[model samples]
Target chain A: MENEFSIEVRDLTKMFGGFTAVDHISFEVRHGEIFGFLGANGAGKTTAIRMLCGLSLPTSGKAEVAGYDVFRKPEMVKRNIGYMSQKFSLYQDLTVSENIYFYGGIYGLKRKVIFQKTEELLEKLDLKHARNTLIRDIPLGWKQKLAFSVAILHDPQIVFLDEPTGGVDPITRRQFWDLIYEAAKAGVTIFVTTHYMDEAEYCNRISIMVDGRIEALGPPAELKTRFQSQDMDEVFVKLARG
Target chain B: MRTIYFILFKEFRQIFRNKAMLPIIFVMPVIQLIILAYAADFEVKNLKLFWIDKDQSQLSRQLLSKFEGSPYFRLTQADMSREAAETAMERDEVDVVLEVPAGFERDFLAEKKTQIQLTANAIDGVKGGFASAYGQAVIRDFYGDFLEENAARLSWQPPSGGTINIASANWYNPEMDYKTYMVPGVLALLVTMIGAFLSSMNIVREKELGTIEQLNVTPLKKTHFIAGKLIPFWAIAIFELAFGLVIAKILYDIPMLGNLFLLFGLSAVYLLVVLGLGLFISTVTETQQQAMFISWFILVIFIFLSGLFTAIENMPPWAQQLTYINPIRYFIEILRSLLLKGSGWAELQQQFYILLGYAVLINGLAIWRYRKRS
Candidate 1:
């Protein structure tokens, strides 16, 4: 908490009715670090991310995002963080520039700022030619990339990507990581969730979630060595099964 | 504020892009206004009639000629027997049946009193009643004329020369054209439907597409987000209303006697209520299909109870009590009164206040129910 970590979760818990979805999970995402959260189906990765993003209330424990308390100052937390979900969360009927302007506007960016950001983002993504094209007509891989770009259009302190690369081709996945690297280079913390074990190797630090709790938290290399495995996949299998 | 604008812009883009919704929003109302206006006339026309003139005398023949000459009734058959007249009435071919008793002329000459029997279909009671009244009036006129002519022949005169005492005048729509009354009400119905139907699907669509989580993570306040989503549909609903009114005026010859600005202003306020209800529904429902189904169900009840097709006063007491809560009832009433009766603010202040309350209450409920956590 004393350090300049962008996100800090201390024994965070979230429950729906009588069922616990994210149970007493504690972790930290350092500034500018790419943290990978890996989990199987219903592994509570989404629930935990939701709590950290100020999108859901934790049943107990506490967390802070960009130095703002999750419960008492969730609005501040929301303002400093960006989020992209697996489903390509954007208005499909809207054009690329329209989506950027809309999301940027919601984040309280000035019109001139939104205009400037829209021009810069489209050029950076090489989407200038299709800026006016409806998102529904764009290729799926481009849509995902554009969605990622839109999420961080306001230059938030942290960007949360919930399985952002799901259903994308390997080449596009690689390109998507390049964008994440670029954002990380700019001192923006990247908190991402994925089922793709291979992606965990690219993170600065990685956590494995199983049955609503964090099973392992460390750099990819350290986690693999500690579990006596050759790769992160084997390490996850050992920890998730245990 | 900017976020809400973005939401609104996106919503408009989506509405324009969806081919099916555009027609449902804009075209359907105009078509309904045209078709229903033509079909929903309370003034019965082309009425088929059968008369039993038992005497077949010159005087009876003259009375039958009066029925033939009247525009209200098309004398389809002159049956000699009472049984044939009754059969024609029951078979639905004839809406009205007249029985001129055997000694009608004789009794009129002797005692100055005669009776005629008129039977009409009572299924559509209002239409049947109007037809019956028309038939009775025509017969009364014929009898009065007969008495005048008879008095001249006998060289004897009664007081007032057998002149009838009744004078009738129809209010609002003197010509009794259904289109003039129905078009305005339908405009209200259409505007409300667009607001409730389209807005109900707005947030649920994001939820179904799994983008609600993205919106949840935005820095936008809940109220701002909801406002952004609702305002565009509200504007579109108003636009649709305007278009419907234009069509009503141009195509159907609907009068615009009241201030157009007042109509639009009231429509804008009413649109907020409907759009707010739609957003509230979207927040509660999980799927677009559920939103649509629930909206349809609510709309059916609203339209039936809206006093668009029937007078609210004619409904049962308990049902009439429910009309006080229905926003459509007031809107339709205001629109019709203003458009047809040229009613001013003073005449419609009660309805205006009720609609204003509905607009505020519904939007507040929508904002309250839209939780940041869920």
Candidate 2:
């Protein structure tokens, strides 16, 4: 049977020696959905994303990403997903075009395809003038947008973004979200982790994690009414405090 | 294969763009080689000598004059007593002492043979031994002159059988130029430094910059990543070798006596051993500083044990055995043979095969140690 969910986890646990970093957590993300994974600092959001992205192996549990077992077939999962870390991970010494070319080349895309994608991506972001500019020479906002573009340049089935917009102006953050919405509309599953409560409202569905456990999961409006809160900010604070 | 090519292309672009990195890669080694060539020499000169002659005979005077005439020794006349001469040696004022006993002239004329005691400070043993040997040769030549002068005083008969005389010749470096011996060793060092230092820092820099995280999530194969890292540094180090050789030819007048292709071929394998070692170090280290420290520690040992300055034969049996695994030592041996002795593939087969083994084993281990999932 074809898998309906893009990512599925059943009792995923990761331990470092005696301490458990991620407790037995279970969740599923639907295809083409904007899934907001919300938690306070050290609430196992990053750990969960790492396991699902196939960068870290779970100590015990089952995780299927893009219909491939994360534990048994991580390479297949890797080929089918894209990742943008919280830190600006592109080569600062390299130009924007070079960074895109490198990422696309590593994903085994054809040169002509990469060229076409580069042109389109630059035009869409209105960064045509900054095409040959070094990554370090650009503003933080532009680097973040370019990072997201490079991550999805391979057109993976799912894209994992770990706190991609950590620190940016409100307008830039909103613009960054617009890019995410556009990618989502193209049927790319976006699994984003973030601290900004307002940005969490943009997700179609949200799961609030408290100390490695999913305390709340549903649509944002449903979660707000269930928690008797006005917005995602109050729901997050109430869930974290509990 | 294409993944490796792309990574390599990216690496080269980044390497070429860094303003500091280009000078370090291209210019620094050549400058170090030229300066170090003039400084690293084994030839000892200007040894100080002290003489205390108890025998005031003409023969003793002649011997003292001989020491003064030779350019290697400088005679000190602070005090003629044995105690004073020993004190001078203790103070590092003199390196050798000649003590002639009282009956030297009487016994030499009567008994045809007399002994002169020569004492040398054997602290720097190599220099001390050479100095003492020079003193002995001067005395022997003086003895021959004495025999000629005393030929009329007493007729001496020769032995029936003729004595044998030994003659020696230096094959390639007939004048024993230390520069010729050192240029190839220094060239080997240049390659080792570039291969070890640059590559060991490559991955760790990515880790420090958080770029490795982005790479880990991608579908790049472990073998492909390793090959990508290896190929760029390997090609650069090979270019470095060729460049240094041309500089050696122009500046030092050192000849490429053997087949250039064979030398280049062996150097390619040796570069793998060095670059693999660097990549292996990178996998274990968490930061660029730690990688630099660890590679520096290992490289110091490799340089000292490579027989660049000291002879491998002079080391202990176990240390000599350890040199067998040192890639730099093998390269130095191959280079010296090729540049000085004009050694061909027939003669260099042993070194070539060992390097091949090293290339395979080290690169295999490096690729094995590098994991995509972790």
Candidate 3:
């Protein structure tokens, strides 16, 4: 089952000059599992995600994303994965529909397929009326959710979300999580990094990274029991304190 | 190819939507062409002159009449004292001063010897030289008429049994309108200006907007990404070239003697070079402001050295050597030859190859410099 992991990492390490952002660590993200990567500010969560998403080369390590070597087959990895950054990167000047088309087009989806997927996704998100509206005019939460939908428009094997729910109202955040859950249930592996402790509880498995190393990794409930805490937040605080 | 088309469509839509950019891209060049065309005439229209007539005889009066009758010179004042004319020259009011020496008509009648003094302002050396040469030619013509009138008295006849006569003809652009010569070159510069300035910031702008990272994560190949960004600007540049040619034809009445197909073909190739150059700038520079500044610096130098404003032949030998690498120099030469000289492919093959080579070299360099990673 471990060999069936969608993402495999061995001794993954990234260093910037004298600073080590991601220490020599190993982890595996299971196929069809929602894995939460939790870290405080500057705990190297984004850097680690960047490596896993094949955006940056690791200083020293071997990692395979979507069965492609992150070093040699980055293009293959890119083709098989979707990524949404913390910035909710979408062209503000472009309409939401235009952004969908652009992203879908670049991903090699047929025009008809893109159109169909765009209509379906907009309808599902209840954003069909605002399809022609520029992304900047929409509220930030809607843009974040739309960005995530566009990222996975091609139905990649794994979707990487970097703090996808940051600075959003709780209701919008729950809606965003519903979208993530829907993708995960459809057998798309979800690897997300967030500082929100409650969001971490929603993941099937959670890893707490501190000082460039994973301090703990297990099922969220088991980790809470092992830490003798009522919830994942107290568990994370207890582990962090230790 | 589809990705490139999508990117190009988006870029075109954005450019059209931006009201400020629309005028800058479309209207400014036409306005500059008209204004510069009128302001840049080389034909010295109004020339100021003062004359000193010490002789006050028929010959002297006749010489002064030549100056006054000529459209090139305007007689501002006349004085018997050369000193007053000299003062006028010092004050910069008079461009040229002609002094008839105090020999009256006695010298010409008795000894057939006379000398005229001419003074010119030398501040603008070229204008001063033309004025002095014009004055000398007028004096020579006046003397020739006087000599012809007294030919029998002096027994003046050609020593040869027959006289030789020569006639010269100026070909296309007979009137030598400076605007005609400049319009084609200006059109070329305008295409280059649009390409270098507009396209250079394209990728840098994406990077600034953080869209580049989004693009990088997509399945789009680097070549596809570059082509997508390049194609729209290439089309815009070609359209600008066409628009410029239309203005050249309608407003300046510049004739297109060469094949329009050939002009478009060359313009397409030249625009590729410019687009490549712009992309190369975008890849190297980190900011849009830097891209613009660098493009401006390159364009100013290229335009100055392109022989549109100045003759490359008159430049120093070392400076002329630099023109070989200057793409605008070759483009201007090609445009002028095609439009004014009606040069065929055989005549323009050398420049064609140069532009083609530059297009490949710069584009290859730009692509090589561009990396998916930082």
Best by DockQ: 2
Candidate 1 lDDT by residue in tens digits, B79-153: 778788777777787888888888887876666667888888777788699789888888888867776777766
DockQ metric for all predictions:
0.72, 0.81, 0.59
Q: Candidate 3 docking: what grade?
A: medium
Stretches of candidate 1 exceeding 4 Å from the true structure: B21-26, B101-115, B154-156, B161-164
Error of 2 at B268 (Å): 0.6
Q: What order do candidates take by TM-score, descending?
A: 2, 1, 3
lDDT of each: 0.85, 0.90, 0.86
Lowest-lDDT window of 10 residues in candidate 3 chain A? A233-242
| Candidate 2 colliding pairs | none
Residue-level lDDT tens digits of model 1 in A51-149: 888878889998999999999998899889989988778888788888888888878889899899888888888989998898889999899888888
TM-score, candidate number 2: 0.94
lDDT of 3 by residue, A131-171 (tens): 98988899999999999999899999999999999998999
Ordered by DockQ, highest first, the candidates read 2, 1, 3
lDDT of 2 by residue, A50-100 (tens): 999888889998989999999999999999999999977899999999999
TM-score of chain B of 3: 0.93
| Candidate 2 residue B271 C-alpha distance from true site, Å | 1.1
